[model samples]
Target: MATALATKPQVSAAEWEARQQLAACYRIFDMLGWSEMIYNHITVKVPDQEGAFLINPFGLHFSEINASNLVKIDIDGNTLDGSPHPVNRAGFVQHALFHRHLPDAHCIMHSHTTAGMAVSSVEGGLQPTNFYACNFAGQIAYHDFEGVTVRDEEGARLLANLGDKRVMLLRNHGILVMGQTLPEAFIKHWALQRACEIQVATASMGTPLLVPDAVVAVHQRDVHMAQVPGGPGSADFAAMVRLVDRIDTSWRE
Candidate 1:
């Protein structure tokens, strides 16, 4: 942990703040039960540096992540800070494609939650059965599972499938949420996870689901309108940060 703190002097104030926000995001994911051991990743770009980003050290649990321990790297998967901990190669390969291709995607979160994977395996992806699901209507992308997304060539295919979309369902794998800000990505992941949970539970009952198209359209428009700068999600994210701080403040280290 001391070694992690040592790198703080090497970065700018903006990048340092980005690290803290990203670290808080990791702790928040742990608290929400979204982390998949040390396998999945949540990354945020360094402000004003194209192709440079911060990701969790590969072996540490999400709850163990902190602003100091986050690893800095470029789009080519090279660690810039020379940290003892290694970055997840697969995570870098997958997330870098989005960071390089989409300029607005400042934060990217990938997860393998039970409900997320369950919904990914189904025929229709993210059925608009509920309000949370409706907000993603016509806004989700799909990419067929190609093993573990390690190869360099697979990155292009993944980006092609995810063209201009904020959320994607990695078929037979998991879900990826992109955001212009950390809070937005976290909120999208929360909503998508809830939608998947609802789908799984409702499907288990063997009852036909009903999603009115007209109503879904209206709700989708309203959701878009509500997602302005410094909207409700920002407040919710601040509240979650306070909650995490109350629980363990160590993540802020």
Candidate 2:
């Protein structure tokens, strides 16, 4: 558990709002059973702060995170605001690479969920066996894991592997999803995990899965075209926010 800070640094209204949304993301992760203890990370770029972002404090469980407790830091992992909690070194290195290199990747989420890790270790990454998997038919990337991501040089390899893709399966490590918004990122992560879960369950039956290439292509096109303002992803995310609000609104603090 992390010790709560006695005070929060003064920040801009936009920064504060981003903090609240990011904190809610943490709680949502906990509610969906996507958190791996205090490991992994979800980071959002501060609205107007160049190269600055917000991440969860190192020791807090996802459920225990709140707006004020999140640590604000630059791309280099230097603390921007005076917070007592230290940032996760590995998390910062991995996340900062994307944030610095990709402009559209405003929100990034990394997970170590059972299904996600299982699929990552498989021979072929993210097979298009179902609708969920098909959504990532040609939009996913893969990176081989080189143990814990502590070395700074690993960032370049990560970027190269993740070229022009929204999702990446870290072989033998985990999964990552990057998006223009927090809701989009969360929705993509949810879809990827579901795809992995379905793949594992079906593979255990030892029956040759039959999803036609044509069908997968059509599904991928449909998913991309349906990505509108009030579409499935955004709508479901809004509903989730309402559910999280009803359960415990402390993350807003």
Candidate 3:
């Protein structure tokens, strides 16, 4: 009789790298107080020819996520792999819209941080309060409140709100940031959330102060590149990943 063949499970080098970065992104969000009690999500596109992606298993707190704990799903929000926890279909709806439509959006991050939501609810959302906030000037998009984003029907509106911009404020909801690379996506998220905090604190002072002029804001945003040791692709996002690891290496395990 002919010997039977066994197909070995495959995990490419690219997939392993994506898994590490995706896991690191989760840890960073957890450390930053951006998590919403196991409600928010950060998803990354799978590597190679696969159009699927991975996200934190539902019901698990962000701090509890590990490289192996993420569940894979397709653009339609169907679970491609079996896991103990259910996937967040509501969260994935928005994520899938971006991954399917935005070619540059390799990683997508959504959060319900207090500051972020506060800004979103304000009459003026995400004001260009400082240099960090200027990058969003004339670029940020906002989606009107349409109840919870759980159905496939919500995808079109979400995509429309996102348009071509990589950053958005979900009106009366939360914040969303996407990037061509995982590191850039994570950094943009951090920047947006921090800017929201600053804006809220400044507004609380109840003082009318001068805001930077559009020219000044744009200049500052551009000049920030000089302060970084390396711009864009050369920045030390890997350092951020390592910092997360040092703080809690268990995420890797």
**On residues 160-205, what C-alpha lDDT tens digit does candidate 3 reach at each position?**
7777789999989888988888877877887788888888898888
Task: Please list the C-alpha lDDT of all candidates, in the order they appear.
Answer: 0.87, 0.88, 0.77
Instruction: Write one digit per residue (lDDT tens) for candidate 1, span 143-244.
Output: 999898889999788888888888999999998999988888988998899999988988888874668889888887677676646753687788899999
The candidate scoring highest on TM-score is 2
The whole-model C-alpha lDDT of candidate 1 against the native structure comes to: 0.87
Show model 1 residue runs off by greater than 4 Å: 1-9, 224-229
Please provide TM-scores, in order, for all candidate models, with all chains considered together: 0.94, 0.95, 0.89
**Position 110, candidate 2: lDDT:** 96
lDDT of 2 by residue, 1-253 (tens): 4675436558899998899889888988899999888889999999989999999899988988889999989999999888889899989999998999899999999999999999999898888887788888888899998989989988888888888888999999888999898888989999999999999898988864767889987776676676667644677677788999999998888
lDDT of 3 at 125: 92
lDDT of 2 at 153: 88
Can you list the residue pairs that collide in candidate 1? Answer: none
Range of the 10 consecutive residues with the lowest summed lDDT in candidate 2: 1-10
Model 2's TM-score against the true structure: 0.95
